[model samples]
Target: MEQGLALLLALSLGLLQPGHGQPLHVEPPEPEVAMAVGASLQFTCSLACAGGAARVRWRGLDIGLGAVLSEAGSSVLSVHNASLSATGTRVCEGSCGDRRFQRTVKLLVYAFPDQLAVSPATLVPGRNQEVACTAHSVSPTDTLSFSLLLGNRELEGVQALGREEKEEDLQETEDLLFRVTQRWLLPPLGTPAPPTLHCQATMRLPGLELSHRRALPVLHSQTSLERPDPTSSEPPTTTSPQATPQQGSTGTPRTDSSTRTCRPEIHWSLEPVSWELLCEAACGPGMTVHWTLAPGGLAAYKRREAGAQAWLSLPPDGSRTEGFFQCRLDPGGQVVSLYVPIQKVIPKT
Candidate 1:
């Protein structure tokens, strides 16, 4: 009778409990996610088990980020408009028989990028081209600024504005969404034809728990003005390595701890067979002007290194037929560069 009871108990337990050795599986295929602000993001939790009905649960739905859709054997967490508040790890769980499983999907929200786009692929000297930079689909237009530079000199009056600034019939939301456009008119370039025109867009986000990412968002774009070959410098060539200027007075006064600018006085005297070009940068005597030939190699420096005043004799023969003479000054190891034309050398006929 006892043996019969034990057999009956065993049968009952078998009928009540699920089959052993099959574990519940819960996972998200791609847990790491990045989405633009106001975009849609969704993830479904995977669940597997044997011999029992599977069920699922979505967590973090109460955070006001989005809604969760529960289906047969799986559940999906979705953010229809992913904002900064939606950037975090979203959790989902599932159960099969007595087994439970958990999975998390991380999401990130971003704005103020893609990249900075600048129009007019190349800039030419003496041409007043309107240069425009766009911070595509950025949020929070206020406090965002752009800076425009032509060969390291900041051009003024670049204003950062978004669609909301011009569209009078736009609705306001928690975060304003629009493309930022900043424009600056390229001045008649007097420095060099091949000026490095650089544009940068910078935006500061609020310091919050937006995925623990507090770093600022910035975008950059640049194009060089194709410099025409100097009437004296050679053909297209590689740029010379930047020479470390010394602290002594070399050409001009210090513009700052880092830069020095000079308006060099250039003239040439007559030699028998060749004309001698003389350029003076008055940082005082004992100052060696760091002469450089830009957009080409220094074999064009005329190898004629001099003090305060530097001279490069011209036959236009064994040397360059055309190139710009960049007069550089060093004060505190900062080299300021300015290109001068041979027009300064009025050879009196």
Candidate 2:
């Protein structure tokens, strides 16, 4: 009877020990978790035992950040407004009967910028000015960069002035606020249209990156025009008449005095031209030459490179030429020539 009581007591003592026959299991068996800044993360710890109900509590081991713990049925730890400093180890403890259980998990957080902004929304034209851009609420501030864009073109020579960091106290936690500023000198504007400016902010890490962009309000400026000089005197020129031979019955020029003088003007230009020297090619990735003269007449076309001596004759079909071209028209023994230089097309990166 004594041996039987001892055996029963030993068995009861073993049963009273927590996790004696059952183990503690934590969800997300992987020990580490990664989360983005300003995001939320949750960790659940559960206990399974042949014994009775267990008491559970969650705690952070490596960091002092506060997390929400739910212990009604299962223990859960929830972290909000995660930041780079929030990375650490978390522990969950459970007690059942006279035994204790614990589990550990690791956390990792990534930092990124929140937004981009431009100061002095409107930029004035034709004035030497400076424009400022800011990257707001960025983490890992040293990795943040700012760029400026006018219309769709990226502005060159933009410089980063400086950066500052401030400590912000939130309702639940404290955060580091980083602001980066960049400046660019605005060129004089000659167009009446308002220029659009874009501020771009980028944050880069080993394997993570974030970007944000914001556009400034339309720029306004006063355009100055040159006034005419009233002290200058010049004579206005008059157009002369051109002689047109009277047509006979057979549509031939008559040699009589009835012939009259008629004036006809000739001008030359490219079909499509712009102030810029750059032009799109007519063929595959090459430069094309085009020259045309107004008032269709007997004309000839020739082309040659700037350094080349020989000029190549072009067919009258108005086909694309490879180099600089010139069109000549002979009317009344007066010859007129129009030259057009072909600009090479540059490939964009």
RMSD of 1: 19.0
lDDT agreement with native, every candidate: 0.49, 0.47
Backbone collision tally, model 1: 6
> Poorest 10 consecutive residues of model 1 by lDDT?
211-220
Clashing pairs in 1: 230-323, 231-322, 232-322, 232-323, 233-322, 233-323
The lDDT, on a scale of 0 to 1, for candidate 2 is 0.47
For residues 14-60, write the lDDT of model 2, one tens digit per residue: 53233334466677666676577789867787765455776777888
Error of 1 at 181 (Å): 12
In model 1, the runs with Cα more than 4 Å from the true position are: 1-28, 62-66, 113-171, 176-349
